[model samples]
Target: MRSFHVSKPRVITVDKNPAYPVAIQQLKQKKKIPEGIQIRQVKYLNNIVEQDHRFIKKRVRSMLGFKSFDTATSILSGVEAMHMIKKEQIDLRD
Candidate 1:
């Protein structure tokens, strides 16, 4: 909201979720997003996010559910660590 008020972007692309338009309307009512700002709900606009989430989702589903916050955090941390390894963004030494 701060960015919207400060920069006052000309156009914003969001998911095709119907809730977004309503939320934007609320923002306009609150004078956050400018009245003339264009809000586009594009399909496949969030594909990159969805793709990234898929990897995490797969691991979580396979585990069914994590028993505790510490375990969940540690497990997800390792998952992301391996992902970074595969992407060559980080190196783990033996």
Candidate 2:
């Protein structure tokens, strides 16, 4: 996962997950990130993603459970589309 923080209106700090470490390591070793870019080894910051799981659980509960995988998938597909449409209206700016 990649995270970008905006300090000012323009300044950005991008933190890429280093769980594997190889990608960042290679980028640094090959100088792909360039000089003056600070690459700090950080602990896993998975709280945001973890917190979102509760919503999935809530959605599941809202469905009242499915008897079969196909039924679950069908319900999920429709629910996901509805959710996307609702969210896109709020998120997508023309």
Candidate 3:
């Protein structure tokens, strides 16, 4: 979350995971996240985002696992770039 360097969100929608509520509470108590932020435990709200990453998951599953964080980060970044290009989401010409 801190790595994104974005403004605090007003709401966070997550899957019905048992640990997420506890984790969010802990972050609030530690002042890492705002206390007033709303948490919604919805099953389908995340489907769109999850669907978008399905291709990446399928691609990485064959590799078993990455040996280093730096290598994983580099490879994942390239994968995402290629995905965007394939989807025509990014314009190649400057």
Candidate 4:
């Protein structure tokens, strides 16, 4: 959330985890996230997000672990870029 530098989300969808409610409550009390923001634990919504990143997870899982944070970051960024290109979400210009 801090890294994205985006506006506060009006809603946050997460899986049905016991800890999520506690953590979200703490964040709201600390003014980290808006108090009015809603949290949905619909399995379908979570499934969609997981499916979208399924490719990335499969690729990373085979690697076992990354040697360094910098290398991991670069590799993951490249993976995401390639995914976007394949999806035609990015246009290439020479």
Q: Give Cα-based local distance difference scores for all models.
A: 0.83, 0.58, 0.88, 0.85
Q: Return the TM-score for each candidate structure.
A: 0.54, 0.37, 0.73, 0.75
Q: Tell me the deviation in Å of residue 21 in model 4.
A: 2.0
Which residue runs of candidate 3 sit more than 4 Å off their true CA positions? 1-8, 87-89
TM-score of 4: 0.75
- Name model 1 segments beyond 4 Å from true: 1-14, 17-40, 91-94
As a whole number from 0 to 100, the lDDT of residue 6 in candidate 2 is 27
Estimate the Cα RMSD of every predicted model relative to the unseen true structure. 5.4, 8.4, 3.6, 3.6
Candidate 4: give the clashing pairs: none
Model 2 residue 78 lDDT score: 73
Please tell me which predicted candidate would have the highest TM-score against the true structure: 4
Which residue pairs in candidate 1 have backbone atoms (N, alpha carbon, C) closer than 3 angstroms, thus clashing?
Answer: none
Taking the tens digit of each residue's C-alpha lDDT, what string does model 1 give over 1-94? 4565566579777778899899999999999767998888788876555567677899999999899999999999999888878888886776
Per-residue alpha-carbon lDDT of candidate 4 for residues 2-76, written as tens digits (9 for 90 to 100): 777767778888888878889999999999878999988766664666677888888889998689999899999
How much does candidate 3 score in TM-score? 0.73
Query: Tens digit of lDDT per residue, candidate 2, span 1-94?
Result: 2346623222122235544356655766897654445544435444444444555578889778788999888877777666667667446666
Worst 10 residues of 4 by lDDT: 42-51
Give the candidates in order of TM-score, highest first.
Answer: 4, 3, 1, 2
Q: Write the per-residue lDDT of candidate 3 for residues 1-94, one digit (tens) a residue.
A: 6677777779887888899899999999999888999988897785566678888888789999788999999999999999999989999998
